[model samples]
Target: MSTTTAPEAAEAPAAPQLSHGLKQRHLSMIALGGVIGAGLFVGSGAGIAVAGPGIILAFVAAGLLVMLIMRMLGEMSAAHPASGSFSVHAEREIGPWAGLTTGWLYWVMIGVAVAVEATAAGAIMHSWVTGVPAFVWVGIFMAFFCATNLTAVKNFGEFEFWFAAIKITAIVAFLTLGVLGVTGVIGHAPGTANLTGRGGFLPHGGDGLITGLLPAVFAYGGLEAVTIAAAESDDPRRNVANAVRTAVWRIAIFYIGTMALAVTLVPWDDPDVVALGPYVTVLQLLNVPGAALAMKIVVLIALLSAMNANIYSASRMVYSLVTRGLGPRALAKVTGGVPRLSVLASCGFGFAAVLAGYIWPDTIFLWLLNSTGVAILVLWLFIGAAQLRMRRRVERENPDLLTVRMWAFPYLTWLAIAAVVALLALMTTSADNRAQLYAAGVLVTALGAVGLWHQRCTAATAATAQEPGRTP
Candidate 1:
């Protein structure tokens, strides 16, 4: 393996490029499934609890924000395709400090996300077969995904393709059932009873709706995974463009549509909505046989699918960072077009998180989860900032590179940034959310300081080497 740093690594002959093993179909399915995760399947119940039928509004708001973010990311990514995605754009258009901060923060966020998904999946399985321990299930899941990601990149794509297909099919079927129940085709239509009877929609008022935004936003976190995968596809530019173009419908159908159906079919205050999850609650309300078992099977698939993709994304992210001379050179080594070392490192962190759960289930484990809870919001800020600068640079230096453009130029870009800032402020105001924002803040600040310091030192070293009297 080559042990070259950033500036030198660019010239290193041994530094291998990632393979274009992903196909358009893989990207298409990934784009569809990226937004539909355990977060939407399981976490949306909390949003409903807070916002009632108004949760639909919260999801729509969050969905629009994510759409804007995706547009900006697609603009930059299609212009300069790379496995690094926004990290590479950040470094070039912003600075090395920005790149390091964005890449490493995302790597940590996604790594923790892997643990989150595994834990959720394991708990679901353990519920079915109580004899097997939850942590044991987590370990099994972690090992399985680690092995999958360590092979050729196509294996990851194929896994995600099928995993996504299963979940998508399940969601479509659920929506179809919801439509039937709502129109009285299958069962008695509640006829707006569920939505209007329960405190008349905005039960908790505007504050509750604002509070609901936190989870609503978090559920949209994984949509960026498609853009990250774009670099490995045969046509990064076209694939990314197509994926972004379809994000609107995907978010509408999967997120906003589901929230609407969930709130319409079942009372928002139903305890089972929170306890049994919204999907199962709706199924049970409609008198579907084996509702719990059916949704549990679907939820398990969603969690496991998300876990696999998170590991793959985290590994590729860190691998991109290391290849640019940001971290350990050994991790940058790509064999068979896969960064196997980075895969292990990502899965290792996830397994460590599992142990943390066992050792300190209450304090330490909660902190670990909270720390990553808001990391996606921070990375979105980076994507928006990078796009703001890169759009102009590309237009001036290489006009044709603007294969996809951010809508409304600087205006919408500014709007996106301001919206993120507003969400962060809202997070600080909530007692439940305050801890998560603070934990994420501490980690991001630490990483930013280190990135800036490293950037300055690298600059000074380069200047010194260029001096006339310097030794060659």
Candidate 2:
């Protein structure tokens, strides 16, 4: 028998196929769970406190912006679906440098997000086991969910489906009961008593409305998970298109409608609305049975679900980066059609996030979170830019695959980019959030510089290899 050498062993390929196990329901639920999160459940209180009833308008504005971003993303994903989502598109349409920066930046954001979500869940779950510490809870939650993600794509999908279903059910129930209570169906006759009773719609005036817009936009952050999850489905193109459409409508309804209901059921001026959380305050006012406890459970579910989704997304993105020659190629190796190494690597950030929070909750952790403050905004801007270029290529190469086209092509695409920039500019005006915006700007600048350096090195290395007399 002939012995194979090291070269031969190095040439052997590992498994690379990703399992397509996500079904229609899985896609639907992932889409739902991605957008509706703890942000909406709890974070909206800040906006409600600031804008009062006008928070509904803020949600509408942010929702529309999100819709535009989704449309641009859907168009690209439909034509060419990739687990990397916008990062892959950026590479093809923009440049290798843009893709590198965007992918790494997005990965960082999600990694941090995973840790934050775990910490939040751990805090809430601390009550169940008095002796066990919060960090241990974070570790346990991260380990268990990471295992599920490492097992099969379908497993992640199923987990997210149930997770999202619970959130949706809670939101729908709250909206229904709140609406009935506000309309006086539960007590008094139908009226706008709670809505205008406080200080009219613009309680704090237009500045409050503007202030509310930023939080509303951030609340829509996890939406890109649907597009990322699309690659694990059999009919990714069709699934993404449908999911995008429905997700848009649901965001508008759940965000705008829920905000409207919340403010209407419970006066926005009420201290409990902000201090106790808008959802809980509204539900308690309606006297829903065990509203506080139920909402607590729901918040935990939402955070954990988001953490699970992020773990899956970040792993896929890293796997895509490796396949594209932008990451450690070892991560590209697939076990059971899952990027197990990437999953482990992505989940590793949980420790870093926890440590940062522990070390300096006010400074270091704040910076880490703030550094990603405008990350979603930056991601959207890049996606819109990618769509502008990719659209022409898709039309020329495979027009038939243009099942999900961006609205108005280059025209609307430019508008979306401009809108995102405007939002960033708007962010700088807010004293509380400006530090985060500036920190994100600095982070983005560094990423761009590093990406440029990497590009130059790659080009130089390629050129040297082409020279017959030059040694690499």
Top candidate when judged by TM-score against the true structure:
1
Clashes of each: 1, 0
Q: Which ten residues in a row have the lowest lDDT in candidate 1?
A: 1-10
What is the per-residue lDDT of model 1 for residues 310-359, given as tens digits with 9 covering 90 to 100? 89888888888887767888988888888889889889988888788778
Off by over 4 Å in 2: 1-14, 468-472
What is the Cα-based TM-score of model 2? 0.94
Model 2 agreement with the true structure over 1-472: per-residue lDDT tens digits: 1111122111123465888999989988998898788888988999999999999999998998898899999998888788888987887777767777898889999988888899999998898777999889988998898889889899999899999999999988988887788767875543677678778989999889989989999898888889988988989999999998889878789889889888877778889877778889877777777888899999999999999899999998888877776778888888888989999888887567877887889998898899997899999999988888878877888799889988877888888899889888888787867998889889889988876776677767778777998776
TM-score of candidate 1 relative to the true fold? 0.96
Candidate 2 minimal-lDDT segment of 10 residues? 1-10
TM-score for every candidate vs. truth? 0.96, 0.94
lDDT of model number 2? 0.85
Clashing pairs in 1: 6-325
